[model samples]
Target: MLIGCHGIPVLPPYIISAIVYGSLFALMSVSLTLTYITTKVPNFAQGALVTAGLYTGFALLSINKINPYESLPLSFLVGGVVALGIYLVVLRPLSRRGAPVISLMIATLAVDIIFVGVFGIYSDYLYQVKKVYDAKLFFALTGADFSLFGVNGVVYTAPIALALITASLYLVLTRTRFGLAMRATVENPNLAKVVGVNTEVIYVTSWFVAGGLAAIAGVFYSFWQGGEPDIGSVLLISMFAGSILGGLKSIYGAVIGGLVVGSSEIVVTTLGAQYIGPWVTPYEPGIPLLVMVITLLVIPGGITSVNWRRLLSRGNGS
Candidate 1:
């Protein structure tokens, strides 16, 4: 029911939903991939960090009456602190002790479990103490959203935020001294250390950046979809699927993979429910899993693994 330029009708709610979800997923996938590139450990707690942001924004909204959009900076800081704490307290020590990659990953999973409990406790406190009955579960207040050209505010905000974040990251990574050191550290920590770079500081910075990105994604997610204490855990599979589909090491690939997966998850399900049956709705989560499996089977290296130049040359010759 939205009007486009020239009074044309465009961008139904479902399409807007896809765009917002895809943007947020792309942001999260970039964050997840960044951590993996920096520290060969897959952060299972990434989702929990996202939940932390969700709660932070929710708490501000319910108590202080701060808009979720306005509370994003605080959410980023909180999530960054939590992520940095995990790196410093758990991963750093074990890493120094030469713990295996699997062990480090398991430690992240343990931290994720711990966060679930913490979020649960916080949820209880919010309901009992703050008396926000919907603290345990909540959706975005549509009334608070503005419309432009008949599109919801989030339809503009999510994509714009993703673009800004991506541009900022690109500038930081490719055009700064710290970025040079960080890239060197990522390429080879020992070599970077021997060359006078502080790999530990780079690691800390990467984790903090990753956490902040994930939190920002979470805030957008709450604006696009509803949020709950454990919703991040539920979305963890999708996040991993996006990361894996992107080849896990390429940040740009992660962005593309997330946009593909996120949009398809919602759009495909909606189409199926409209044309096939209602049963398709419940199987939406399977879309990412199926995409992940297909990616693994067809192209283990993911989308970035394909050599576009070679493929184009073949087409020209034909």
Candidate 2:
């Protein structure tokens, strides 16, 4: 029941909101899965990349007065650089010294802690020196926006960004030589080295791509929901839930898991508010935790491991 400025119509607010949020979640899940595949690290610092992108977008919009869309590429580069630095300086050296996976994962936790401090300091600086208002958890998506056909810029852009990233990933994984090398390294790093593939380069490239995707998703998310310095930490659970729901091993499964988790989080919360009480909305974040716990108990392998054809046949009694 929404009318556009050009006399066209767009989806209702709730549906549009779900789609936008779900798309961003899907993008993050895919990015996370990619990182896990290549590095065998769950990457707790992934959330910091999102936070970095959020601030990058805020700086671009508030200080530079740049369009949000224009900030995405810059955010991607910033994220890539941060990710590369972590890998090259910290993770790579640890690996060279034969650190275990647990040690590497802990390293990511350290990185996350460091970034939180950096984000907090920057927030203070922006508020005090730059005179930005409430910079810590600043909700900046107020009057600054553009409209497309009949939809807000974010409404169209979020899904489009996800689609482009997905398509590009498919092309890179299937058609590109670098992608082949990456796959080889992920499958068997030792074997890849024996076969002349540079595992170091593949690892670096994977981290870069993962960071870029996380940043892009953060920018899209900030567009619709507004940004906060620690917003990524809050979202880390949902990201993990989606990746786990997807079996944590398959990229395509991550997409399905994210869509399901993201859409259900909103839809179920809305229904809960309607039926249970309005107060249920405040506990919306609990939904992902419940989903993740139930998923681990019922189907640890996740949606990708299900025999969909058999299940459909049983439904038809065939």
Candidate 3:
């Protein structure tokens, strides 16, 4: 049982899990939304880029014995570089040739498949050369965590990281000249280019930022849920759901959408298991899928598209 700072019982494990998962999901979703806004391409390989970060942190921890938190900077760089490479090597050339959006999306899917194979090869290398037998399939390294008031360090760290990242993004986007250029580029690339905004640089910078954010989220996710080669693939659905629910067009919306969907996935699944029996546990992934479907059917434009003020005024009038 976990205790609070004052010795009273803290929230349940499942709730803690929800907070950590939701925070990570929000981070990843924000990254996805940023990429979409800048490039207008739904990066199917976003999950694989995250997995690259997961492996980066995992490799440092498993081999160098470095703390996962300490490995974050390197993970960010690796993820950013890979994502930038993908954009330059694959997407940009295709876009230049006037490839359609669907083709660009397919290219991303192909990249994801390639990443899976690469991760598999790396996993084999870890097992064969490094002798980390569980490199391919491993559980969380919770033993590396320090307890805070009997709660795992991640419980606080995850939310703190999310808060800091979001705040930093808000400042960067609002206060910087580059951010103004980025906004303009996203709004209209040709117009921004005409004004000498260097839209190409903005696109590269945005992809790098998005990849770094996803990788940072990946590092935390490995700490919370364990690292695996295909963990990103497993998480892709939830990330997309969060992005879509948040109204893919708004970065802030992604945050809220991620928190809601991630929390609901865990809480709803746990509740179902408790009340409906263990059989419901296997259907855990369905929760986010259902939420996505319902969101699409009802509010296709997402949470950000809804006019809460008007709705409230109408309620008052009634």
Candidate 4:
């Protein structure tokens, strides 16, 4: 941490934190992108699943007294299971009817409402209630950095982890049958089905996969940010920015969007405080939203949509 001239500031670590935070955003965006891909709907309840993910991580890490790192995987399981239930009870029936856009949006919004209400009840329950888990465990993951592909003075771990996760996802989407089925459903469900694919199964699996990815992101979020219901309420904004940046169509676009959203946030916080000095508190959150709007208005196509096959061919050629 260093200060520039005229009380200007430099905190490289926070920039890295932005990347980590952005990675968390990316994880949620992955789920969001997938939902958009297969169902051709935004899955507005994405934030709800994000909250569920946070709770799952908090449950395993705080309530179960599990080590936070080891407890991480449990969060993904919980996310997947919850998403599966949501699709079965809520989304599947509607999709069967070929629900219209507004209908699907309303349905997912209803799910979001349910999630918010339930989480509120839990928050109240935990409030004057006994702490079943060690609150100390919740505070354990303070500040830290990791070093691979890091500058000598600055270490970057979150971004590195996120990159690894993104790579793994890319491989899955490009190199697997399930991936093809998933994309097939995205391109055209009827056509995919006509070609001997089970579109229904693809959708259900997509929801599960999306929810699970949200959980993985949520776990890191709890690790990165201390877990609480309020955080979940606020996370929707970040997720939305990431999705919009990714063109809301391509998977890799979401990755770039998450990074941009994250970077925009950190940059604003850093520079805003130094220049404006007073409006900092209220202005920070809006930076990404502001950036998102400008980007949408400017680059309509977003981050250049690459045919997955083209990207793969280039990689092989290289």
> All models: lDDT?
0.88, 0.84, 0.90, 0.72
C-alpha TM-score for every candidate? 0.96, 0.93, 0.97, 0.82
Candidate with top TM-score is 3
Angstrom error at residue 316, model 1 = 3.0
Candidate 2 structure lDDT: 0.84
Cα lDDT tens digits, model 4, 55-158, are 76666544566654565567677778878887889877887898898898889888888887877667656543746343322442443213233332112444
Tell me the deviation in Å of residue 226 in model 2: 1.5
Once superposed on the true structure, which residue ranges of model 2 sit more than 4 Å away at CA?
A: 1-10, 140-142, 314-317
How much is 40 displaced in model 3, in angstroms? 0.9
Candidate 1 collision pairs? none
Once model 4 is optimally superposed onto the true structure by TM-score, how far is the C-alpha of residue 299 displaced, in angstroms?
A: 2.2
> Runs in model 4 with CA error above 4 Å?
1-11, 132-157, 305-318
Maximum-lDDT candidate = 3
Candidate number with the higher lDDT (1 or 4): 1
lDDT of 4: 0.72
**Model 3 agreement with the true structure over 43-80: per-residue lDDT tens digits:** 99999889999899888888999998888899999999
Candidate 1 stretches with Cα past 4 Å from truth are: 1-8
Question: How many residue pairs clash in all the candidates, one count each?
Answer: 0, 0, 0, 1
Output the lDDT of residue 116, model 2.
90
